[model samples]
Target: MENINEALGLLLVGLTTVFVILYLVGLIGNGVIYLTNRFVPEETMAKRKEIVKGKAKPTNPAKIAAVIAAVEAVTGGKGKIEKIDKIDKIEK
Candidate 1:
């Protein structure tokens, strides 16, 4: 009975220690990210925001032709591009 009790106690302590360490790591990681973003310059942040939002620009005709050609080749002339639109990349 004593041996069983001692083993259980040790197991509990080990689990608790692991949980505390993981929690602290998560807390510190969040804090660092928050601070870094908060201190970032507005201009740089604006650029990042624009990139995240996927601001559209005129497409190069040569690039568009190349993409269409590749798609047709891959699909054996069955693929067609009706429209193209910019999509923002989602970050976790």
Candidate 2:
């Protein structure tokens, strides 16, 4: 039927238009992120010369990562570790 054909054509046109619009939005978002990163580079954190002072051995990166992950999980991603210090002894 001519009506059915016309409806199908309209549907196809609408879908194509939406897809093109979404694709353009995605492209623009990516372009903005790329431009921002390129123009305003993120600052790098300074590396510590000594993670532990006197008697304490160097800390393992895996342990640090696990601790950070645990803190994030506990705080629901609101926690941040500013500094880590070695505990010489624990009081009862």
lDDT of each: 0.74, 0.69
| C-alpha-based local distance difference test score of model 1 | 0.74
62: Cα error in model 2, Å: 40
| Candidate closest to the true structure, highest TM-score | 1
Residue 13 lDDT in candidate 1:
100
C-alpha TM-scores of all predictions: 0.54, 0.46
The reply for model 1, stretches above 4 Å from the true place, is 56-66, 75-92
- The segments of candidate 2 whose C-alpha lies over 4 angstroms from its true place after superposition are 44-92
Instruction: For candidate 2, write residues 6-36 as lDDT tens digits.
Output: 9999999999999999999999999998887
| TM-score quality measure for candidate 1 | 0.54
| Candidate 1 local lDDT, 23-77, one digit each (tens) | 9999999999999889988888887676556553423556656667888999999
lDDT of 2 at 62: 64
- Per-model C-alpha RMSD: 6.4, 12.9
